[model samples]
Target: MFKKILIANRGEIACRVAATARRMAIQTVAVYSDADTHANHVRACDEAIHLGGSAPKDSYLRWEKILEAAKATGAQAIHPGYGFLSENEEFARACADAGLVFIGPPPSAIQAMGLKAESKQLMEKAGVPLVPGYHGSEQGPQLLQREADRIGYPVLIKASAGGGGKGMRAVDKAEDFAAALASCQREAINSFGDDAVLIEKYVQRPRHIEIQVFGDTHGNYVYLFERDCSVQRRHQKVLEEAPAPGMSETMRQQMGEAAVAAARAVKYVGAGTVEFIVEQREGGDMNFFFMEMNTRLQVEHPVTEAITGLDLVEWQLRVAAGEPLPAKQSELQIHGHAIEARICAENPDNGFLPATGTLAVYRKPLAHTSFQRSHLRIDDGVREGGQISPFYDSMIAKLIVHGATRAEALARLDAALAQMHIVGMATNVQFLRGVLRTESFSQAKLDTALIERERAVLFNQEPLGLPLAVAAAVAHTVLQEAEGAGRDPFDRRDGWRALGAAVRPFAFDFHGETHAAQLRYLHDGALYLQVGEVAGPLVIGRLPDGETEVEFNGRRHTLRVDELGGTAYIFGTQGATRITAIDRLAHAGDTQAEGGRLTAPMPGKVVSFAVKAGDKVSRGQALAVMEAMKMEHTIAAPADGTVEELLYVPGDQVAEGAELLRLAA
Candidate 1:
């Protein structure tokens, strides 16, 4: 094995690679941008080097800088962890030219699979089953529209150089094909710098299943079973599992053989994944078509590791060192069922838009830290006070669980999500739990549209009831009194009513609605609350671990309350809610702008303006596109009106809620 290696990436994947390298007694070097100077990955390695700016093009994507850092640190090889330069064929070749080993597939393999248009041709020539579509080299808009019409309506416009659901759009009719193609091509150019695209027939009831394949310099190969990545949102996998539900031995073997053949055709080396779009049919028949091959380690590789009992990164290191395949196809075996949920800092209720902020309070489930339970694991590269900046991916961590059966794994995953607590920003933890508890998921009836199919229950947001709201106010007051009293019990004057019952009024805002309540402190150490025609006496007790227990209407409930920046965040079994204290006496006028203004939802750079000033638009029409957190968000018109002003141009970075345009009423 190489003595020292450089990890040319950031975030959790970089930390993950460092863990494995350290176990192999190999020193690791980490490269970071200005945004990630104090990042977790930098702390995981023995040495670190500074890259450039926070944007990927200025830092992680700078292959020359990465090579310089590697050479300066005396690293013999470089591991491109998943994103950024992982699939850049030119970067791989540059590493080779610098006399440093690239711990991934050969540059030839990356080049062959990097472009979907050409890869489809290669797969077809290799006898791999392919979907019916247009994979030709013609890049004309008219030619692409003609092909889309030929493939019938509901065709998919996909960027030839896209992954992670970027630069792809589904058109349902001929009239929408032109706009969809333009948007797809624009995103393609912005993301991959390639405007070429391919049109394919959209498969109904499609299930995404990919086979993990590995190869060595000695020309040996093996398939590490498969992962079912069918549960997706916006064409990106949210939850993944190994040993796909209802998979038969015969189908597994056939898919495995096909995957190996595709890899051998390119003379693949190191780790790669062969993705397939499997179409479910009546009876038990399924037909799978080759989608694309990822020429590096995958984000969902942990699920593969849990089932196969192999460290894929370690395998990458060994193979890059010219070692033979660790095990033959017949020697590998699937152990137990495993599932992984990608925990992202995103708001599921608001179209899953990525969120950026400082993590005032971050805590993972305690179950993941028990060494006795080897089945539960968490892979993260963030700390409690880290910031989720807009310059990188929004994925905060991945929670993986294993069990003897799929049912057990599902149960464990749900429990773990419930135990997680994150403050200062929204996350998808509750959304993930809702998916795990869905009837379709429990029965393993999964597909790419599962989330959309279960949208009603998945997006349901229950109101923060009066009970919880009252509990939050009381908890806040109790904690404040305790802190002010210091260590002396005599100084604790909570509920003291020597001058008769005292009434304290509290104002709070929850979910855009303001509420007020009055708390009466009785001389007998009791409290009573009255709010909007509801009057009740409540009992509050503090637990040893700082949790609050509230008794109301003869029922007792325990909740965790975190007060930060004058906002009391209460977390219960139902979910979490933020209650900000309002000062009614010193209140100011509302700062919200009128509804006719179109504002940026988050901090991002303007990618394009579909409509300019004086252009008439209808409600729900796309007005502009903003790119943030590596994803594009479309800003639409609120009402049918003429655009009066365009405030910002393309490539201008704007803050959240910055007015981008105004529509004439």
Candidate 2:
């Protein structure tokens, strides 16, 4: 095993690698950008080195700087933790040239699998099952459109050199093909510096299952089963699990063989994943076609680890140090089911827009990062007060759960997500809980389009139920009384007391709507609250689990309090939201823009314009494309309008909500 290794990445993955390296008695070095100088990964490593500026280009993506830091720290090997330079073939070759081992697939394998087009070609040559599409070298729009036509409508336009959902678009009709292709190509050029794209047949009801394959320098290889990554949004995975739901033993063996074939075709070394898109037909054929192969450890690798009882990072180190495969494929066994949900700092209600803020309070459930037998697990890198910056991926943590069966695992996932307490930034926790409660998902009927197809019912931001309003009122009363009762006689209690008059009604906003609530402090052991005709007094009970329980009418609700910038947030049966003590200056002015004109949603470079100064566009029509967080977002017209101004051109880097185009209603 290597004595010291450099983790050429940051954030949770870096920390994850460092933990495994430490367990194996290998010292770890961490590289960080200026923005991540105080990052969790840097604090976890044995040694740390500053890369460069805050932007990824200046730091994480600078291969030379990373190499220099690795050498200076005396790290014998470099582990590219999933992103940035993980799949960069040149960087892998550079590490090899510098006499440092790269704890990943060989540079030749990365080169062959890096480009989607070439990988597809290689898979086809190796007789691996491939989807019906065109991976040809043609770049002309007309030619690509012809290939799409040949493949069929509902074709996928994907960047040949793309990952993380960047430079990918699904066109359901021929008319929309041209615009989608142009937008995709522009994003491809900007993100990957390659405008090359390919056409693929879009599989309806597709389940994304990828096989985890490991290879050693002695040409021995074994597959670690597969992970079902069907739960996705905007072509990005939100949840994943090992031993795919509804998977048969026969299907698992077949996929294992096919994945091994694809890996062997490239003479793959170290860890890699062979992704396949399995189509669910009426007969349950389990026919899977090869997607591209990821030439590094996956973000969802923990699920595999939970099921297999193997440390993939330790294996990476041993293999890079000229060891053979740790165990034969036959010896490996799937102990139980494991599921992982990505907790991202994004607003699921607002089209899943990414949000950023200092984590005033961040607390994971008291579950272990790895479970024995069946339990909940969490893998994360952020802590209390960590900043969820916009310069990197919005993912804050990966919550994993294991159980004896799929049903149990799903239930644990729901519980863990509900137990998650995060403040200072919006999250998709409720959205994930909704997914778990979904009838189709609960029944193991999932597909790539599950999130998009069920988005409406799954993402409810309304505060409609009367019970929730009453609970909020009671919780509010408890907090108010807690603030008042604990003080001495000199403290003023009449913010709304008004010297023994009618109770003053106050409004509190939760889940985007205001609730009218009345509060009265009682001399009893509880605080009294009234909402319309409903009345209740909630008792605050301390729980053994370190979380407070709010009780009312023989029912108990767990509450987690988080304070951010003087604002108090209460999470529990009231769902999750900011709970201020009914602000004194409550009649705040509207934050909506004066003219109701549409603007950019985030800081990104404009890549496409569908309208000019005078073109008429309808509501929800694609008006422009903005690329941010390595993904493209199509900003649409808010309402039917005539374009009055073109505020930006292609390649203009604009701030969030900066005017991209003015549309006159």
How much is 577 displaced in model 1, in angstroms? 2.8
TM-score of each: 0.96, 0.93
Give RMSD to native, each candidate.
2.2, 2.9
- Whole-model lDDT values for every prediction: 0.89, 0.82
Model 2, 289-331: lDDT tens digits are: 9989999999998889889988888888889999998899889
What candidate 1 gets wrong by more than 4 Å, as runs, is 367-373, 486-495, 531-535, 588-595
Tens digits of lDDT, candidate 1, 206-238: 999999999999999999999999999878889
Candidate 1 local Cα displacement, residue 643, angstroms: 2.4
Estimate the lDDT of model 2.
0.82
Poorest stretch of ten by lDDT in candidate 1: 365-374
